[model samples]
Target: MKTAKILKVATFFSWFACIGLTIKSGAILVTYLLSISNPEASKNMYESLNLFEYYNHSFLNYSIIVFYKIVLFSVEAYIAYLVIQLLKKLNIKQPFNIDVHSLMRKISFAIFYLWIIAIVHNTHIQIIGKKHNFELSLFSSDFVFLSLVIFIFAQIVKRGIEIQSENDLTI
Candidate 1:
């Protein structure tokens, strides 16, 4: 009963999170397009890019860094969507449903993908961000451990579904 109530809350919160993140993504898209045309748009976006500190900002360099930021935010929005799906699956009464296991697996995969994107993105940022004296967290061991745990939990969910199905057959 307690778990069900918690799942219900999580499902609704996930919906809210998904909507908010999608809106933020759309706003970033608008800003990115606008930044292409207006000179001031570049300045506005350069709020903290350290453009002049390390090297002069060329349109090409500014554009690449901006695009990378947008991609990173888009990944965050995608992860939110995956979380919503996982939460909704958990909201279902049947804890051993195959769909639940599938959602967990998808969530784990999304996390792994996000982890990879971060590493690759930060690598470029390090080469560039460091040149400008920008603060950067290039990698996270916390994420590494969490990703492994989530992936293992997904496998456990898969095993639970199989066991439930076998139990159903016997009855």
Candidate 2:
């Protein structure tokens, strides 16, 4: 009983994390769109958008970039943890139920779509000189591929859970 309750709570957290990911993903998409729509305007806006000067040293800019990367990485890591919990909830020992499978498929599809969008956005930044030289296209591609694989695995697990549920119901 306690484990069930814990699983439920974890699922809720996963949903919450998904929401945050969606918001952050949307922000990145919007920024990318804006940049593409008006490159000159985007450049001007970025140049004028000064959050902090930090005693006239340029190191602050790099620090801020590092901080943003750290936060983004942390969010991604949390989402991955939540995804694992969700997969555990599927209890993939049995298969035949449709509900769990369907839900998992939808989530997987959404995540894949989001991954594609992120890759596109990142690529756009790299092309536009907004990203650093260290940024590689392969990195974005790998992230998208990994996300797709994880989501697909989740869907497979959910399908198993559904089948189990159906067997239980029939018996």
| Top TM-score model | 1
* Residues 1-171, model 1: lDDT tens digits: 788788778768877777776666566556657766655554443333333322244566656655666666666667677777777666355777777778777777777777777777677768866776665534342455667788899899889888988998999
Q: Give the TM-score of candidate 1.
A: 0.79
Instruction: Give candidate 2 misplaced runs (Cα > 4 Å).
Output: 18-96, 130-146, 154-171
Candidate 2 achieves a global lDDT of 0.49
Scored by lDDT, the top model is 1
For each candidate, what is the lDDT? 0.65, 0.49
Worst 10 residues of 1 by lDDT: 46-55
- What would the TM-scores of all predictions be? 0.79, 0.44
Residue pairs clashing in model 2 are: 94-160, 94-164, 95-160, 95-163, 95-164, 96-162, 96-163, 97-162, 97-163
Candidate 2's clash total is 9
